[model samples]
Target: MTSPTIVTAAMLAIGDELLSGRTKDKNIGHLADMLTMVGIDLREVRIVADDQDAIVEALNALRSRYRHVFTSGGIGPTHDDITADAISKAFGVECIHEPKAMELLAAMYERRGMEFTEARKRMARMPEGATHIPNPVSTAPGFAIENVYVMAGVPQVFQAMLDALLPSLETGTPVLSRTVRSPYGEGDIGAPLTEVQKNHPETSIGSYPRFDGKSFSTDIVIRARDATVLGAAETEVIAMIEAIGRSREKHQP
Candidate 1:
């Protein structure tokens, strides 16, 4: 049997606010969901401060390891928004103000009756040989250099940029998943579930515990690249739950 094609990706979320309690990150989850829909498995995510060295180091590691690397935050016009510079350093290139990006931002600012100040011009800066990722929400575009896509920190803008950029990327087969809910807790099914997982190597079985104030139960999620394998594993999980139920009933006097 032929193995399924799997395209993997990693995410770098850059900003001091993210590390601090100032700003909550919403872009990471959005990116993960969107990438999964397009068949790009987001395998890892790292959050770093606005430090240039940290961003460069994380970017280098992720870009080398995955098919794609997505970065959010630290690409704005402010002095601390240093993602562009970090990316340039990572690729050993100079971050310059691209003429096309400058033009786009200038026009948008002109229409908004705002001055395109030196600070605003900083938004046009990108790594050498980088392509612009269009930002429909804001005219200040994100950038793509090689495998890394640097996007905005704002959730709305990040999502818009990703939506525009996703069509150009190659995708693999989307993974399928099935969930089986059991009234039993993890303690009740842990041993058997481990056996089920070992028996079916092709499927990934994850057990999540849920609480409803009164009691705790388990939500077993089975994921696989093939539908047949996924369904087979799901069936085994359900059977295991049923057997546990029967055992509980047998013990009741």
Candidate 2:
């Protein structure tokens, strides 16, 4: 049987705090796992300061190269929040207060008896022709223009926005992965691992080394969209490890 087509995606993390080390980013990994579950391969990740030129450049580049581009951060009420404007420029469209977004924000503030100040209203602005990505955690919504999806930077809001947006996206066959942890060091298995990767071109083999202060071990993970290919590759990996074990046992004093 033929393998399903792969859907690729890129992530753009936008915020000066992220770059300055003031705020640690927790969205990329979440998005990666979520996207993978829905058959989208996250190919690239970029972190740009909250600058219009940077955001626009990264957005245009990623949107052109990947099937989807997910951006987190810089979509808030503060003056520094310029993701909406930058996205508009990147798509060559005007920025405006989207009616639906305005209504949502207005209702949210009214419920709390707080004035919908202009600053808070800024959250309603989006690139013209953009579609809202619901934010259940906060009234301010994210948006999607073309292939670029702009989301909140706050972890909770970002997760909520992603959860809402994913259902509407087109997904491919979910990728499957198997991991084998061995007490053997990576140095001992690196050569055979390379051979295994070459033999199984349809699967991706990754060797991750772990050091636990006193000793070293390796985790061999095999990934592929096809279950058959993945199983076959995993078998080869296990056999290679067994062979190495036998060789070591024979040489023991």
Candidate 3:
């Protein structure tokens, strides 16, 4: 049988606020969930400060390793917002004020009766030859160069930028999952779970233990791109749970 196509991506969250714990990161989880729905598996996530060298190094590493690389933060109008410069260095291009972005930002500010200052114009800067990622929340647009998508750091703006960016990307087969709950602990099912995993090489099996104040239970998650394979593996997991349940009953007073 032919294997399903797998498209992978990596995420880079940039800012000293995230590392300092002043700003809680909401982009990584949102990006992961959104990418999974569109069949792009998010393989890695890295958070870096507003240093140019670190940003450039991380961008090069991730872009080389994955089919797509997404970045958030440090593209604002301040001195530390140097993501555009880092991207330009990474791709060997000039970071210039993109005409289209400049037009959009200028128009938005004019309509709002605000001054289009030099600091605001910095929002229009991007690596030359890059495409724009629209931000409906704020008029300052994000930019996409080659396989790297540079987006806003603010959670609302980042999600809006992603909604605009996803349609342009190539997607793979979506992964499906099933969860089975067991009253037993991981200890009771470790060996059997290993056997079930070995029995179905096409599926991924994971056991997570949960505590409910009084005792522990397990949640087994089975994941696969093929529905048939997923169902077969799920059936095996249910049978294993039943067998363990029966054994516990037999030994109980």
Candidate 4:
């Protein structure tokens, strides 16, 4: 048997702006796609305000449920930046001044002719025992502790940090996916769709309903690592969809 390995992750977006609909969170989608390419499963994503209680609760829950938890936002120079402290409280550790983070921030500020004020110094603070996640786009760095990977609020900076960090992460066998679309409603093929998944426990069969105003159809997708398994699953799916085609329902599936 193939060695068992699967890396699961949860994404946490922290900020009042995202919840208020003032800012659209684009990091989750980017993160999901990036993680998928690297064989890491994006198990779940949580969005919360810049509240200490909320951050603590979310971090604790995700850590318990998923193998990896990624938090974005609340790591800025502003007064509302409090992610580090909340994380510290959750892990029962002290939020202390991180020397490596300080050095990076100091050198970055010096180059940009910016003052490293008390507010700016907050960027250097992280949970004790957490390692820094380098931010190539901006000076403020992200940090990782155990399975939790804390990142920046800014989308651009967060993506840069992810690029630098994801490559080194241990991953599972890359999941392969294939989608087949037909002019058939999900109800027409739901029964056979269920059987295919039951028959092939290793493959997951998904049916997505779509209405293009002119017609309705279901996009059947099969996901699995073994190529042979995926092919067998797809064949069963197409045959089932074809069997459900009615004279009036496009006569196609």
Give the per-residue lDDT digits (tens) of candidate 3, residues 1-253.
4688999999999999999999999999999999989899999999999999999999999999999999999999999999999999999999999999999999999999999999999999999999999999988999999999999999999999999999999999989999999889999999999999999999999999999998889999999999999999999999999999899889999
User: Can you list the residue pairs that collide in candidate 4?
Assistant: none
Q: Which parts of model 4 have CA positions greater than 4 angstroms off?
A: 1-4, 244-253
lDDT of 2 by residue, 1-253 (tens): 6859888999999999998999989999999999989999999999999899998898889999999999999989999999999999998999999999999999989999999999999999999999999989977999998888999999999999999999989788888999999789999999999999999998889989999999899999999989989999999999999999999999999
Q: Candidate 1 or 3, higher lDDT?
A: 3
Q: Which candidate number would show the highest lDDT if scored against the true structure?
A: 3
Instruction: List candidate 3 stretches off by more than 4 Å.
Output: none
Per-model lDDT: 0.93, 0.93, 0.96, 0.88
Residue-level lDDT of model 4, residues 34-74, one tens digit each, is 98888899998999999999999988999999888889999
The residue-by-residue lDDT of candidate 1 on 169-195, one tens digit each, is 978888888999989989999999999
- How high is each candidate's TM-score? 0.97, 0.98, 0.97, 0.91
Task: State in Å the error of residue 163, model 2.
Answer: 0.6
Candidate 3: 10-residue stretch with minimal lDDT: 1-10
Question: What TM-score would candidate 1 get against the native?
Answer: 0.97
Candidate closer to the true structure by TM-score (higher is better), 2 or 4? 2
Give the count of colliding residue pairs in each prediction. 0, 0, 0, 0
Q: How accurate is candidate 3 locally (lDDT)?
A: 0.96
